[model samples]
Target: MEWIIGIGVCAVLVVIFTIVTYNKLVSLKNRFQNAFAQIDVQLTRRYDLIPNLVETAKAYMTHERETLEAVIAARNQASSGLRKAAADPGNPEAMKALAVAEQGLGGMLGRFMALSESYPQLQASENMKQLSEELSSTENRVAFARQAYNDAVMTYNVKREQFPANIVASQFRFTAAALLEIEDQAKRQVPKVSFS
Candidate 1:
C-alpha cells in the first residue's frame, strides 16, 4: 500500500542524512589537522632561523653576548615546547610554554636590534641587513600561520560542539584543540607604537 512505500522512503532518507553528516564531520576534522600542520611548518622555520640570527648578532656586537645567550636559551626552550606540542597537540601546557618562549625570544631580538642601532656600520653591513629582512619575513609568516590555525580551530570547535554534530564528534573522540596562549601577563597588554 501507499503507507508502506512512504515508510520505506523515510527510512532511506534518514540513512542518507546520517551518512552525509558523518562525512562532513570527517572533513572538518581533516581541516583541523591541516591547520595545525601549517602552524607546525611555520614554527619549524622560525626555530631554524633563530640560531642564525643570534650568530649574526654575536659576530657584529660582541658586547651583546648575554643577549645572544638568552636568545639561544629561549630557542632551546621553544624547541622543547615544539616537541611536547607535537607529541600531544591537545596539551595546553605545551602551548603556554611555547608562547612564553616565543615572547622571550622576541624581547631578546628587540635588544639585539637596539644594540645594533648603536653601531651604524653594523646596521649597514650587507649580511646584517639580509638577516634582518629574513627574520622580519619569518615573523610575518608566523603571524599568518597562527591566524590560519586559530581560524581552523574555531571552525572545528564550533562544529564539534553543535547539537547533532556534538553527538557525532563524541563518538569519534574529536576533542577540542587549544589555542596558542599568551603566557606573560605583561605581554598580554598591547603596547601602542606611534610613528610620529
Candidate 2:
C-alpha cells in the first residue's frame, strides 16, 4: 500500500513540473512576439516619413531622379521584407534581406541630403528643415525598437537554455532569435563626420 502511494505522489509532482515549465515557455514566446510588434510599429512610422523626405528633397534637386527612385525602391523592398520577417521571425535569411534593404535606403537618403548641401536655400527652407528633423527622430525611434527587441530575445533565449527549461524547450522546439546587425561599414571604418 505504501509503495502505491509513493508512486502516485511522484506522478503528481512530474505533472506539476511539466505544467509550470510549459507556462514559462509560453510567456517567453509571447514577450518575443510583443517585441517584434514594437519594431514593426517603428518601421511603419519610418516608411511613412521616407516619401515626404524624398518629395521635399526632389523639389530642390531636380537632377537626383536616380537617387530618389532608389530610395523608393529600397523602401518598398524593406517594407516587404519586414512583413516577411514578422511572419517567420526565426528565418535568418529574411532578416538579412531586410537589413540589406534598410542599408540601401539609408545610402540613398544620405545622397539626397548630401545633394541638399548644394542648395543652401533649400537647406534653409522650413519644409526641408522639418522633414530632416522628422527623419532624425524616426531613426532614433527605430534604434530604440531594435534595442527592445534584442532585450526580449535575450531574455527568451536565456530561459530556453537553462537547466530544466532546456528540457522543456527542446521538447517543444523553442528556438533562439537572431539579433539585428548594425548596417553601415563606412561608419565603422572611420570618423564619418567632418567639420571642414
Candidate 3:
C-alpha cells in the first residue's frame, strides 16, 4: 500500500514538473516573438520613409539616377526579406537572407548619403533636411529594437540550452533563434570625428 502511494506521488510530481517546464518555454518563445514584432514595426517605418527621402533627393540628384534606383531595389529586397523572417523568426536561413538584404540596403543608403553631400542644393533643401532627420530618428529606434530583440533571443536561448530545460526543449523542438546582426564590416566600424 505504501509503495502504491509513493509511485502515485512520484508520477504526479513528474507531470507537474513537465507542465512547468513547458509553460516556461512557451513564455520565452512568446517574448521572442514580441521583441521581433517591435523590430518589424521599426523596419516598416523605415520602408515607408525611404520613398519620401528618395523623392526629395531626386529633384536635385538628376545625375544620380542609378544610385537612386539601386536604393529602391535594395529597399524592396530588404522589405521582402523582412516579411519572410517575420513569418519564422527562428529559421536560420530566413534570418540570414534578411541580414544580407539589410546590409545591402544599408550600403546603398550610405553611398547615397555620401553622394548627397556633394550636392549643396539637395543638402540645403528644407524637405531633404526634414526627411534626413526623420530617417536618422527611425534608424535610432530600429537600433534599439534590434538590441531588445537580440537580448530576448539570448535569454530564451540560454533557457533552452540549460540542463533540464534542454531536455524539454529538445523534446518539444524549440529551436534557437538567430540574432539580427549587421553583416557589413563598414557599418560595424566606428565613425571618426574631428573637432578641428
Candidate 4:
C-alpha cells in the first residue's frame, strides 16, 4: 500500500513539472513575437518616409533621375523583405533576407544623400529638411525596436535550451529564434596616397 502512494506522488510531481515548463516556454515565445511586432511597426513607418524624401528631392534633382530610381528600387526590395520577415520573424532565412535587403537600401540612401550635397538648392529646401528630420527620427526608433526584439529572442532561446526545459521544449518542438541584425553597408576601399 505504501509503494502505491509513493508511485502516485511521483506521477503527480512529473505532471506538474511538465505543465509549468510548457507554460513558461509559451510565455517566452509570445514575448518575442510581441517584440517583433514593434519592429514591424517602426520599419513600416521608415518605409513610408522614404517616398516623401525621394519626392521632395525630385523637384531639385532633375538630371539625377537614375540615382533616384535606384533608391526607389532598393526601397521596394526592402519592403518585400519586410513582408517575408514579418511572416516568420524567427526563421533564420527570412531574417537573413531582411538584413541583406535593409543593408542594400541603406547603401542606396547613403549615395543619394551624398549626391544631394552637390545641389545647394535641394539641400536648402524646407521640404527636404523636414523629410530628412523625420527619416532620422525613424531610424532611431528602428534601432530601439531591433534591440528589444533581439533581447527577447535571446531570453527565449536560453530558456528553451536550459536543462529540464530542454526536454519539454524538444518534445513540444520549440525552435530557436534567429536574431535580426541590420548592419551598415560595407564601404569602398580607400585609394593609396603616393607622394613621389
Name the best candidate (by lDDT): 4
Compose the digit string of candidate 4's lDDT tens values, residues 46-111.
899998899998989999999999999999999999999899888899999999999999999999
What digit string (tens of lDDT, one per residue) describes model 3 on residues 57-113?
999999999999999999999999999999998678987898899999999999999
Where is the poorest 10-residue window by lDDT in model 4?
183-192
| TM-score of candidate 3 versus the correct structure, residues matched by position | 0.94
By TM-score, how accurate is candidate 4?
0.92
lDDT of each: 0.76, 0.82, 0.92, 0.92
TM-scores of the models, in the order given:
0.81, 0.89, 0.94, 0.92
Q: Which candidate should be chosen as best, given TM-score against the real structure?
A: 3
Off by over 4 Å in 2: 192-196
Global fold similarity of model 2 (TM-score): 0.89
Which consecutive 10 residues in model 2 have the weakest lDDT in total? Answer: 177-186
Expressed as tens digits, the lDDT of each residue in 105-196 for candidate 2 is: 78877777787799888898898899889889888988898888778778888888999889888988887777666487657677558789
Q: What is the number of backbone collisions in each predicted candidate, taken in the order shown? A: 0, 0, 0, 0
